[model samples]
Every structure is written in structure tokens, then in C-alpha cells.
Target: MATKTRVPQTIDAYLAGVPDPAAKKTLTALRAQLKKLLPKATESISYQMPTFKVDGSAVAGFAFFKHHCGYYPFSGSVVPALAAELDGYVTSKSGVTFPPDQPLPAKLVKKLVQTRLAEIGTRAKKLAAAKKTLITERITDAAVKEATGHDWKAWMRVLDKAGAAGLPHKQLVTLVGRDVESGWWRQSIAVAYEQARGKRVVGETATTGFQVGVVRTLPMTAPQLWTWLTTQPERWLGPGATLNAEVGGSYVAPRRRGNPGVRGEIRVVKPGKRLRMTWQPDGWTKPATLQLTVMPKAKGASLHVHMEKLPDADVREAMRERWSKVLAQAF
Candidate 1:
């Protein structure tokens, strides 16, 4: 009769059960270094191997196989991204195989782990975005019919008849405008059509250059955040700021120096929910739209910063960094 083997419930058990001295020593050192680099990560046994997960996402893992050891980034794209630095090592789309006797260098291990972590972070953000409400959700089928005398399917049919799929953004908008009266509704319908046909992506519009948004979750309620934002405007808006918390009210955000002050009007104010406004700082070409919103979450709440009409990708990145800093430092 054949004997059954017990599986390891922990990484330490897995390491101890490795019969090969070289493979055990190599895996032990690699595990120690991974723990050091990923102090915040949760270590667990996944797929019968020692794995390190960060924020519920599997980043890096390792396993001992016959004749060699394997390092897994758990992402197909990670290995390809660093293919140039992986010379002399046996690599696949998912993992890298190294000789057990001559364990991977500390530098190489660091690169592999860091690259996997970065890829995981980017994937997490994209997944979060995918889970958010879509345009169709915001503009419901019934609401569309009530507002424009047609449902989404009907509007799509109308646009399709106009050859909107092959038309440029402006021309498509013009076509929609022949029926839709309001400029805002025309732009919205055109964008919705473009998104449905896979022509335009989220946070992108021909007229608005580029749009970017960032969200930060804080351990507080929406009302609490609203108080902080309305009272402590200097933290985010700028220093010596005067913000009127009402629709059609004008406001000013005076910077210290070098960076000029912003002057704008509050376009929409839904207490503890959303605040939309237009801002044009000193020496700016045109005003940019700024929207701040608060959403309730399980633990606390989320603060949202949405900026539109950015001049280019550079400005988009700059505003992203600026808002990230504000979210991190403020509240």
C-alpha cells in the first residue's frame, strides 16, 4: 500500500518538509528576504505554495520543484516587463526558475517582487474603476426617455442611423445636436454613444483635453468630511482661501507665492454629497471644472476629486499628484 503525505498549512512547515538541503536553504533565505521587503503583506499558503499577498491581491510566491526552484510573480505581464534583466534564468509568462544551489541574487529578487507589486497596484486601481457605476447607470433608460423622448436603445439607433460610428467627435455631436437642443445633453449623448462603440475611454473627451479623478477613503462620515472641506478650505483649495458654499457663489483660493490664486464660482452644491465649480487661477487660459464629492462606505466614507478640461497629459499628471497629496495630507 502507498503512504499518504500531509500537506503544509504554513510556509515554515512547507520549508521544513523540503527534503533537499539546497532547495530548503534557498527557499528559506528567499522567504526571509520577501518578508523583509513586504512587511505589510499577509503571508499565506496559496496554491500549495508560500505566497505573499498585499491588499487581498497575490503579488509574489515561490515553490520548490524537481531539479530547480521557481519564483512566481503571479502576473503574466510582470515577467515580460522585466525580460531584459532576466537573462541566464529560465523564465515563463508566470514564473522564473533558478538553480536551487545558486539561489537568485538579492537584487534580482527585489526587482521581481517590486515589479509584481507595482503591477498588482495598477490592476487594483483598474478593478476598482471597473466596479464603479457606469454612464448608463447614471443616465437610466427611463430617465433618458423622459428627458429626450427616447430610451438608450432608441438613442443608440438614432445615432447609428447617422453613421456616428465612423463620424468624428465634433461631427457626431453636431448630428446629435440636430435633435437634442441643449449643448450639455448633446455632449453627454455623444460621449455615451462613443463609449458604447468603444471609441472614447473614460476620463477622455476631445473638447476637455483629458479628465482625471482620484478617490481617497477616510475613516469619517460624509457629513464630517463636508465640515472639514467647507471649514478648512486652505488645506486643499489653497491658503487664505474664501469659498462660498452655495450655488452661483464666487470664491477665491489665494496661494502663498509662485503658484497663483484661483478664482471661480460654485456651480453646484449638494450639502454632504457633491460640490461642482469652475476654477481659473491667475494667468490661466480658461477655467477648468472641479468637482468634489463624498460617498458613504462600509467603514467610513470616500472623498472624490474630479478635474476636467485639463490642457494635456502633463497637466493631468500634475493635478493627479496635487490631489493625491491633498488627500494624503488633509483630513
Candidate 2:
């Protein structure tokens, strides 16, 4: 009969008790991978396992046990797209378990981490986007106070008028279903504006110029991700010069003896949480803003990126698709 022991609090304690060498090696490799993924994560012993903190909170962790090695990214169930990939893994509310004798699925583990990280990045971007909405909410509230004098029914009428204009079926489900309380109301404002206008609701952009704004989140920590973004420019930018992460830094991409400078002022640099800089190439007419924001979840961080000042709707849509491709490659 198997005896159930109380959960341990530190990774050292769990490792000490586990007698399986394979499990130990698995744990070691996992730790190394996680370190590579999130170098900025602060380490500690919690629940008798290794826990990593991102942006001051625990985002993920690992543990060694008698039967299996456990890897947990606190918020993972929401990632439906990965369900097929994680099909064979043994999962629970807190984590997934990999057996000792069987070969550890390195790719799957990395995917899990990346997915969690992307979620965090999405959250961070939403928070930044939410701030923009908050201001609108305040204005709307003030307008209501002035016009209706606290009449709730009048507000409903205003909302109805707005909803009639915009057919926001998909966006509403995406934002509201995610429980973005702060941004939802403002979406209504967008809807209202759309309803009031007779403009056509066209799809994503088409110009290749916008394709340069590729945004993605990695499971790795800010330092690790930044290293890839800066050091691995050749992999993505097709022979880019280099990037310096400072106030007056510049990035130059050289293609066939011609050096094009991607230079701008670093707007918001909040260490590991956010980085926004101006990006203007020598030949381009408009200046673009490149923004990266990291949001932490239970076990990882999300990365939200935006390349603003795109020329037209078609270009913007193309940029969005480009970002998706970049994300798949990097994250």
C-alpha cells in the first residue's frame, strides 16, 4: 500500500526525499530550461518545490516526487489552443506530471511555458489598453452625470443607441469572455461610435509595410526575452544591424550593403514590465511607436506588443498577421 505524505514546502526537501535518479535528472533539466526561459524570475522553495517569481509574484514552479516530476504554470487551463498538444500529459488543477522512466517531452514543456507566458503578455497589454479605456469611462460617467442627473434608464438608452451601430460580435466575445471588466465598457463606446457612423467594417490590413510590427510573448523572463529580441535580430530581421536598450539607442538593419537605421526615443522603460520606443527608419515618412508590455499571471508573464503609426488599415492588418508569424517563431 502506498502511504500519502504531507506536501513539502521547498524543492530541496522534495529532491532530498526522491530516490529516483531519472526524476532528479529530469528536475535538473527542467530547472535549467526554466532558468533559460525566465532568467528574471526570483527563485524560492515553496510547497517543497522550486518556485519562480516574475514581477514579484510566483508564476511557475517544479517538484520531484516518487512517481513523477511535476511542472506547474499556475494559469494554463485557459489556453485551449494547447489542449491537443498537452493531450498525453497527466494534468491537474495546479500542474502536469511527467513520469520518471519515460523520456521527458522537452518540446511540450517548452510549449506549456510559452503559452503561459503569452497569456501573461496578453494580460499586460490589456492593462495598458485598459488604461486608455479608463479615461473614456470617466468621461462617459461625467457626461451621464451632467445629462441624465443619475438616471440609469437614460444611460441604457445611450448604450442601446451605441450597440445598434457596431456589430462587435467577435471582439465582444473575445474581450468580455476574458472578463476584462475595465475594457468591456469602453468597447461599448467603440460600438456606439461605429453604430453612429455608416463606415464599412473591413477586415485586417493588407500592406506589407505594416508587417514589420510583429508582437509576441515568450515564456522566458524579461532578460531572456530581451536577449533574444536584441541578440537574435539576425534570425528575425534578416540581417539587422543591432539594438541598444537605452534612451537614445539605435538599431540598424543592413541588407545588401545598404544600412537602414531603425532609431527612436525609448518612451516607457519600466525595467521588466514595459518597454516602448519610437521606431523611424531613414526612408519612412511616419514615425512608429514600438511598445512591449509584460503582465504576470500565476506562473508566467504575457507580452503585449504594438507597432503604432501604421500608414493605413490594410497595412495595419498586414502588420497584425506579421506579428502572429513572429510570435509563433520566437515564442
RMSD after CA superposition, every candidate = 18.8, 18.9
Global lDDT of model 1: 0.79
lDDT of each: 0.79, 0.56
Candidate 1 per-residue lDDT over residues 36-122, each given as its tens digit = 999999998764568888777677788886678888776656788888899888876667888889998999999998997786667
- Model 2, 78-160: lDDT tens per residue? 23456677688775434566787664577877787777677667767764664454333455666644543533344446545
Question: How many Å off is the CA of 137 in candidate 2?
Answer: 4.0
| Model 2 misplacement above 4 A | 1-13, 78-80, 135-145, 148-331
